[model samples]
Target: MLWPDPAQRDRLVEIRDNLLARIAEAEREGWLGEVEGLQMSLAGAEEKLTQLDRRQSNRSVVDLGIPAPATRVVGAVRNKSVNSSAAHTPVSLP
Candidate 1:
């Protein structure tokens, strides 16, 4: 497990428990729809947390000594005015 540290593991468990409690409370309050949404959100958060833990445990620095290519900007950019008339009109570029 990436979270070999006891403190980090405990924090993750605390967060999971808090989310579960919130779902339960929502259910008890008869907010079925809200509870469902909350459950989905909590599941996503848990999955991300697990992935992060794994990444932290297996992180390593490797220097390949390769230079990255320079980025180039292309194409003309135009800015449209918000809250303007919907009618099509020629916009002059400065």
Candidate 2:
């Protein structure tokens, strides 16, 4: 999980709080589209905050300390014949 710096996190939270307050006022003003846009913005900010919180937590992996998931082949390579002498060759698209 990616974490933001303290100053950045504080700024984001401040912005989110301000947005929440504005959302209340917007509700009174009946700005439906504005409310919708602000809600999306708030959700994004909240998501980032959640990710930051996760980064701060001390989590233990249950999968035996595996850093990543296993890779599975989906399809075979299109070009199997390798030409070492033409490594830097570039093709022009029509």
Candidate 3:
């Protein structure tokens, strides 16, 4: 349920690179326990990067046009004021 912070992208990439380097060193020294722990951390960092990528992709803008009025105002008819009843009539949109 945690939202990804865009500001942490650079830090996460750095952490992933560091983890990869540590994993290589651990494997060379035959430190199986440390290698397993580093692998788990690396997985977490990579998952966060994936989340940021998804967030970036979904940052498009969409336009929702203005709302229409329930009843439109009609102009005066035959140089006389419009009837109150006619003025309050609901308009149907196409």
Q: Give per-model TM-scores.
A: 0.45, 0.56, 0.67
- Model 3: runs farther than 4 Å from truth? 68-94
lDDT of 2 by residue, 1-94 (tens): 4566655898899989999998998899999998999999999889888877777785666666657877998988676468955777887899
Better of 2 and 3 by lDDT: 3
Scanning candidate 1 in windows of ten residues, the lowest lDDT window is 1-10
> What clash pairs does model 3 have?
none
Please give the range of 10 consecutive residues that has the lowest summed lDDT in model 2: 58-67
Q: Which stretches of candidate 1 lie over 4 Å from their true place?
A: 1-15, 61-94
Candidate with top TM-score is: 3
Candidate 3 C-alpha lDDT tens digits along 1-94:
7977999899999999999999999999999999999999999999999999999999998888888878866985565566857887998999
- The TM-score of candidate 2 is 0.56
Candidate with more favorable, higher TM-score: 1 or 2: 2
Ten contiguous residues minimizing lDDT sum, candidate 3: 76-85
What is candidate 1's lDDT per residue for 5-78, written digit by digit as tens?
54466666777788899999998999999899889878966876777677777889989898999878798677
Report the number of the highest-lDDT candidate: 3
TM-score of 1: 0.45
Q: What's the ranking of the predictions by TM-score, best on top?
A: 3, 2, 1
